[model samples]
Each structure stands twice: as C-alpha cells, then as structure tokens.
Target: MDQFLHDHPITPRTDAEKQGVVNRLKRIEGQVRGIQKMVEEDRYCVDILVQISAINAALKKVGFQVAERHVKHCVSHAVKSGEGEASIDELMEVLKRLSK
Candidate 1:
C-alpha cells in the first residue's frame, strides 16, 4: 500500500460540521447512483445532461463551502502568524484550478 501525506487543518472541524459535509456528499452519491440507474433505463439524453449539470453545481457548492472555511480558519491563522504570502499564493493556485 502507498501512503500519501496530507496536511491537517489548523482548526479541526466539529462533529456537526463534519456530519453536514458528509450528509451532502451522501446525497451527491445517491444522485450519482440515480444517474447510473437512469442510464441503465435508457433515460433521455437531456435529462441525464441536466442531472450532470446539477451534480457539477452541487460539487461546486461543496467546494465553495470548504474553501470559505479554509480562508476563515487556515489562511486567517497563517496571516496572523506572518505566513500570509505563501498561504495566499497556495490558495490562489487552487482557486485557479477550481475555476478551470
């Protein structure tokens, strides 16, 4: 097995926060399964496309939530600790990728 290193958040999420994100992800998972079923049933192309668009929007919403929290907690902490430039740069790079 390969192990990958990951950074931890400066401020850990509360159980409620974790659960909220998890619930949204679970709903998205269900939506994905629904799309697969639709495909198996030969659903209309436009309807499937619409669901895909919806999934994209839902994913973006989740991403924005995580980004907002990162800015509020991580970036803010780094700024307070005099490491804002690197943090901001890292954030901007990821933001550019997200935009793409």
Candidate 2:
C-alpha cells in the first residue's frame, strides 16, 4: 500500500480556509455526539437514520470542498511543475473512491 502511494507535499491554506474547515469538522463532531445521545435515549430508527444521512452528506460536502482546493492549488502546481500525470492519477483514484 505504501508503495502505491505518493508522498505528495502539502501547500498550506490561508488562515481563514483552515479555520473554516476546522469549524465545519467541529460541527460534524457535535452532530455525531448528538446521534450518540439519541441512541442512548432510544431514539426512533428512522430518526437515527435521518441523522446518519445528514452526517454522510456533511462529510461529503467537506470532501468536495477539499477536492476543489486540491485541484485549484496542488494539482495546478503539479501541472506547472511537470508532474501532472502522476498527480492527476492520484486525484482520479481518490475520486473513484469518493463516488462509491
């Protein structure tokens, strides 16, 4: 697995972007905790499923946002630096998984 993975270096995001992602994750964490509490309190099955669906959607939204940033910054850098093929392959691999 390690052999197949590239050690792609990261470019740091602006402070506001970092903070926004963190804030979104924290809200997702809170939502998860709320779901846990609902389970402990014997919440209805459909209600739990609805919250689960919401969590999945929230996570995917975050994923897409990060992907957009990667394409804009990292992929663009790779293409300019002449490593475009490898970088694009890596992105496509992750995208295939995301689609599933």
Candidate 3:
C-alpha cells in the first residue's frame, strides 16, 4: 500500500503518541536503508532476508493500528448513522483482501 493510504479520521494525537509512532517509523525507514546498504555491500543473503522480515512485521503492525482506529471511529460513526450493515460489509471485504 502507498504511504498515507487514506485521509483517516485522525483525532489530535497526544505529543507522546505522535512521537512514539513517528520514531518507530523513522527507525523502520532507517532499517530499510540499512537493508539497501547490505545488499549493495554484498552482505549475507540470510541476514538481508531477516531484515526484510523485520520490516514486513513493522509495516503490518502499522496497518493493524490503522485498522483498529478505523474500527473504533469510522466504523462506529457509520454504524451510528444507520448504515452499519453496509459499512461493516465494506470493512469485511477490505479485511478479506488484507488477509490474503
């Protein structure tokens, strides 16, 4: 998925909350660069693969965080507006795609 996939219903995050995730992502970005460097340096294949797995896990965690927020806020609001079934079905379809 693209960075900043959706214009989400982002509540004003506390400074700490904002910084925590940002720091994590910055670290992930650095790790990505490190992977590139490793490949350029002709590092061990298995080592590079391990870093790739770590990056994938980090990205999945971020996706889960966004999914949780959407369920709590966007889905909540949609359900409140009497469009719950449709909204839920849409969410389910998206989840199904993600699961794949």
> Candidates ranked by TM-score, best first?
1, 2, 3
lDDT of every model, 2 decimals: 0.88, 0.86, 0.78
Clashes within 3 Å, all models in order: 0, 0, 0
Per-model TM-score versus the true fold: 0.92, 0.89, 0.77
Q: Candidate 3 local accuracy as lDDT? A: 0.78
- The alpha-carbon RMSD values of the candidates against the true structure, listed in the order shown, are 4.1, 3.3, 4.7
Q: Enumerate residue pairs that collide in model 1.
A: none
Model 3 error, position 60 (Å): 0.6
Per-residue lDDT over 1-100 for candidate 1, one digit per residue giving the tens place of the 0 to 100 score: 0111026778898999999999999999999999999999999999999999999899889999999999998889889888788888889999998887
- Local error of candidate 1 at 40, Å? 0.7
TM-score of 3: 0.77
User: Residue 45 error for model 2, in Å?
Assistant: 0.4
Cα lDDT tens digits, model 2, 1-100, are 1332245435677889989999999999999999999999999999999999999999999999999998887888778878889889989999999989
Q: Arrange candidates by lDDT, highest first: which order?
A: 1, 2, 3
Supply candidate 2's per-residue lDDT for 21: 93
lDDT of 3 by residue, 1-100 (tens): 1123245452445688668778889989999999999999999999999999999899778767767877887678777767678668878988887676
